[model samples]
Target: MARLFNRTTQQGSRTSLPMATTLPMTLFMALQSRKTRYRSTLVVLAVLLCLSTYLLARSSSSASHTLLHKDMPSDDQMPVVFEEASHSHVSGTARKHRKVHKDREQVTLDPSQELAAISSFLASLPQNVIPLSVDPSVTVDPQLVLDFDTRSPRAAAEVQHMVADVWLRNPVFLYSKLYSPASREVKAMLAKMDLRPAPTIIDVDIRDDAEVLEPIIKRLSSSSDLPVLLIGGKPVGSMKEIRLLDKSGELRKLVAASGAVVDGSKKKQHKH
Candidate 1:
């Protein structure tokens, strides 16, 4: 009985030692688990802080970019907008200039058209009558004198008619010698007068009366020159002198002073 009791006690002591060892191991394990949980929590908090900082930095950068863009003009819009504005201004100016040019053209007369109208009016006159005529006694101006031979009556009549038509003044015709050598000079003078605007002419054929012209020829110092031009009873040179006066614009004033209507349209046509 004593031996059984000692063995049982030893067994009970062994069981108690095992229980204490188990309690220490369980406590160490619980502390380790708590430390691991704390470390995990700290890691999670650090990660969250880093993510929040990153997000804040990104948001600030985005906001700064947006503000920079809003404060300045866009590169794409600057040139296009300004160019369109400039073009509009230039176009408006050009249109105004074009309008002025068009108005000027509308008001200005065409030179060719005016000339044509004047020509049409002149062409519609009677065959034998002059365009305009004035009586010599009505005005105190000079009378244009012409001496002609009537041997060729047709030629002499034609010259008289031309002088009447062009000068717009009546001419006096005088019958002169038909057989004289001076008659050839009279024919030559008539030929020259036909080519130009005629003047007031006085025709004198000496063949009708030699006694009437002998003293007049001697006074003129004309020798054999049968055709003579006299202005205001004084001998003016010839057809050449008349042509020079007309070319120098003196003829218009001279004729106008004598109550002759000098047509400017005719003068321009003669120049052309």
Candidate 2:
């Protein structure tokens, strides 16, 4: 009995010794695992912080750009003088100030009155000057191409009559615009020549039928330019042609040939 009890006690002590050793090893492995997880969490936080900072910086820069753009002025908001300067510099063409007709009375005529006026002006021209037929090679001004298809039949007819009265029927016609520098220059030049039975200067821009008349004038002149000069119902030319004619001393001859008298002491004067 004593020997059996000693063997049982030895086996129990062996089992307890192994359990005590394994418990400390398990605890050490658990502590190492927790430390590794904590390190990984810290690295993840650092990366997130860097990413957040970069995003914030990008957003701030975008916001600043937006604000700057919003503060910039649009073309419409710019001063008139500045706008004028910009436009004048675009084609290097000198922009003359509109100085004519500031004190002149405004004349508005009805369709019938307009027709009568045109007829009277035609009658006043010397009998020797006749309406010349348009040249076929000269393309009609695209502006004069009437969109009769869109207009009421009656409206279209009225416009047609007006166009004929102004361009086709009249022997002397000056197609101009109120604000055009070239038109003003042409007028100034014509004034100096003192053409007898002066050409009717129609400022299409100020006409009530501007939408229709403007295009017709453009088409009849076969040009998109302002200040179309017509003599004997034929296009004499725009400002450029007039200048050329004047330079060569042929303008007076052309005017006289059209049965118009040029009598002005200021005939020798020219526009710079």
Candidate 3:
């Protein structure tokens, strides 16, 4: 009975050693599986982060491109708009210049037209307007002699006599101011031309009654300019009119009509 019991105990010891080794091997395998699962989870998270960043960058680039394209104008339309703006600016500037040019043109008159207008106005006056002159040497104040409508009955009689004096002279009278540039120009032009009867220049500014004489001259010529011309007791015009008439050869004709020979030396040839 003792020998059988010993054999049974020996077999149990060998089986128990094998079971303890198996338990340690099983625990090591389970730990290695858990580590592999954690590594896999980290790899998946890294890949997802990289993919989301790429997508976000692409979307932002596309949005920026869209905004830039929408704000910018097309190349074809730029020149047309620029030209329209330029034309508008030029037209406004030209309009202002044309208005100024038109005003200047209206103020300057033609010689023939001015002469005809003055002649018509003079002929329309009453026949008994100017009576016979009094004394040729009498010195009458211009204010008293020219005041036909404003002054007393004696003033009207004096104006009539003065008008008669001016009418009877039949002179080429030039009513001018001393310091006027237009008057100087007219005088220079006349000096060059050969006229039979010399032009009579009246410098109103140098007169004793300058203020009084100036208005009277203006009323007679119906102009607010100096250097008014008169041919055979008829009002001719100013500097501009004379210049135009001279250019057209009408100045010589008018002078001849007024009984004044122009360039008489040229007409008379020297004997050979």
Best by TM-score: 3
Ordered from best to worst TM-score, the candidate numbers read 3, 2, 1
* lDDT of each residue in 155-236, candidate 2, tens digit only: 4454545555544344456778899898888788778778666766777677544565455456545677767777755677
* Candidates in order: C-alpha RMSD to true structure: 30.3, 17.2, 24.8
Worst 10 residues of 1 by lDDT: 140-149
What's the lDDT for residue 262 in model 2? 77
CA deviation > 4 Å runs, candidate 3: 1-169, 264-272
Worst 10 residues of 2 by lDDT: 141-150
Give me the displacement of residue 30 in model 1, in angstroms.
Answer: 0.6
The regions of model 1 sitting more than 4 angstroms off are 76-272
RMSD of 3: 24.8
Clashing residue pairs in candidate 3 (N, C-alpha, C atoms within 3 angstroms): none
Q: Give the per-residue lDDT of model 1 (tens digit) for 1-272.
A: 99999999999999999999999999999999999999999999999999999999999999999999898886533322211112221232111111111111122112222222211212222121111232321221111111121122233353444443432332211123456454445444434333223333333342222343343443333334445433222333444664576567664455445443345456658889
Best by lDDT: 2
Candidate 3 lDDT, 41-152, residue by residue in tens: 9999999999999999999999999999999876542222211212221232111111111111122213332233222222333121111232212322222122122223
